[model samples]
Target: MSNREGEGKLIQVKGLIKKYGKLTAVNGVNFTVNKGEIFGLLGPNGAGKTTTIEMLVGLRKPDEGSATLGGYDVVTDVGKMKEVMGVQLQATSLFELLTVEELIEMYGSFYKKQVDIEHLIESMMLLEKKSDRVKNLSGGQKQRLAIALALVHDPDVVFLDEPTTGLDPQARRVLWDIILKLKEDGKTIVLTTHYMDEAHVLCDRIAIIDQGEIIALDTPEKLVKLLHSDNAIEFRVIEGELNWNELPNVTKVTKKSNYIYIYSSNLQETLSHLLFICKEKSIIFQDLHIRAATLEDVFISLTGRRLREE
Candidate 1:
């Protein structure tokens, strides 16, 4: 690992490749994350998100290529890199006997620098449960404790893998607020999530990865635009053999039950064409709706399949 002189980017990955025997987990993945930005690495399960992050955190070395965190090569400077990075993996377990505060202190001791435990506890809203053993805490509380352990070192970069998984709505909201607070504190975050809304709300830019490669990388808005499905027209079809392919600006059409969903970039044109077709075919519909396209649509367009399906 080598550092670039006077560079400000917090993370830079160039042509990174990682293999596990016959399988390639991450293949030629390249992207840079600027300082203090929430860069999301998003994909479905088994999309190499975890593999890429493991390499970034120096837990697993790459088979080929280079990745640098804060200008330090991850593989060569594993010790130094670990010191500067705080990580919360998908499954964070703790000794059943350890209290919240004790666990935080234990993790903090590994760092050369000291962190403010009292302040961190207060900020994380763990004061009430600080003395409770790890086994006695709720799922949200455990996740929060894991986050506290990661931050107790005062690292420059933090990686969260599926932080909100298995969390209830209220717990997810609390986690979101905590993430936003981290951003406000000028910490650079690199996270992976299967939630489209989370990526849309939390990340400044996201790379949509799949099949061991980055298929799309951009701001969420730009990604929607690039796919030409930024907005869509959706409604239930009463009955008819409507020629959906003939509709203007209709790039694709999906039919389910009694519903006909149209993917289009020009909403007005598509709606106009759709209405004309419906009238010509004497089709009736109920509960028609129009809305802007989302990251889910972008993912589907790129993969030709839905997120849940993948």
Candidate 2:
């Protein structure tokens, strides 16, 4: 994407880099976020997703390159740029003693412009918990409150760093709806997430970062198309062993925990080969099934590893 600032492109990053002594946290990173778009940085833990967001939002200084939000340089004009930016970090520290309503109001005092506190609470699904202290809220409720605090200023650009991390599935879905509504309200969002489904559902474009460098950048559909396969086979091996990629019609292989995912160019032929190998090796497998290619498969094909590998 072009670095030229305009009405369409609200954020820009070029050759950004960060270092902690000998280790480079982010290396030569570059991208642009369009206005009213949910752009994602997708990768595993410690894959530079959080570091990149921190640098762009001025939480951590970049050692090289430059970026701008709303045409204000993130490094040099942080104060001016921050006025139009709202941030919900991966871990947000809130006043434990304050009620949800009190916390939202406290944050509102930081910005010159303020959105309706009650409306923000309603949008976050925190209306019922408005009287509850921050420490008394459930995990999901606390996350929503953190997000509400970010939006109290009604900023043009919002940075959400793994907003759904550590949340239950139901709570995660609730946050997803809130994020989508923010876009409908004309807010540009920069999202960092490791969950394949989250990135597929929420992101307009994704940057796949690994080991401090971006390996790929494209729409979710386009990224999956890179494998040149429509079918994926997944199962757990109960006995024996097989090199999945060496089997006929197989395109790629990815292993995480006890499960193995095999991508195939010809479904019937590949299944036949897999059966033959299992019989020959006396291998027993379970949960075998075929499905369509997904963002997880794309990441494995590109990086030769799982997205959330420990």
Candidate 3:
């Protein structure tokens, strides 16, 4: 349950805040990302995700608090930090006139050291489009190129902002594979994403931010455990509608159209009550699934709203 775990804090944020005139973008927030782990910043739109990232990368300055990467201040030592970190902003644009290989070389020139272009291109599956113009490439190909540019310097830390936003399922899977490859090479990644499945599959730890504040932070498994819900039984009833207010041991009951979901800490006791009620007033059910709780359910409990809801 420690917010700061692991040795050697690779990235640290303390009392970070950003404001525009009277409106606050990111209130006081603090967290540290360890080396060689995929850290996820998950939140809905307008949750200050972009602002936080921009401040961390030095694109914008924070009005309060400070952030450091590997003991170097992001603002004061911006040049030093920039050399060791690579960033891919959301909806990043590539030079349409530059060929894929040319664009990668351009990015490589920005750093003191250079990476082998042929090797990087091959690793990113961009060998086939090496000679193609940026504008002519498909969305998936453009995404690969963006990732290639981010990794051209073989940086110690990589920051990605929703790299798979508009991609199809197949394209998303491809990007997922690339992310895993980077992790296997022991690169630390910091990403902001709205896709729950993406975070669940790729992130070792996630911080759920909302309204300019971090509401929850933990490994996906640990966050799900916060619900403390076990042996959940989901079903639909036909004969008689059960009143939620009267259900004992039921901590939360939510309904969407005809589907009802009940979360209980005491599953056996709650089920006993449910069966007793059904016996009294005959009810038929379908699609009954008894399973363990998940991070999705945990988010619902924390926010009382869906993650996709704006």
**Number of the top lDDT candidate:** 2
Off by over 4 Å in 3: 1-7, 230-260, 264-292
Candidate 2's displacement at residue 118, Å, is 1.1
Candidate 1: stretches off by over 4 Å: 1-6, 234-241, 249-261, 265-269, 279-289
Estimated TM-score per prediction? 0.89, 0.91, 0.86
Global lDDT of each model? Answer: 0.86, 0.89, 0.84
lDDT of 3 by residue, 171-191 (tens): 999999999999999889998
Model 2 lowest lDDT segment of ten? 1-10
Find the candidate with the highest TM-score and give its number.
Answer: 2
lDDT of 2 by residue, 1-310 (tens): 2444555779889999999999999999999899989999999999999999998888888999998888888888889877888899977898999999998999999889999999999999989999988999998898888888888888889999999999899999998999999999999999999999999999999999999999999988898888888889989999888976668877777787788888888988999889898998899999999899899889888877889887
Give me the overall lDDT of model 1: 0.86
Scored by Cα lDDT, where does model 3 land?
0.84
For residue 126, give model 3's deviation from the true position in Å.
1.2
Model with the higher TM-score, candidate 1 or 3: 1
Error of 1 at 1 (Å): 16
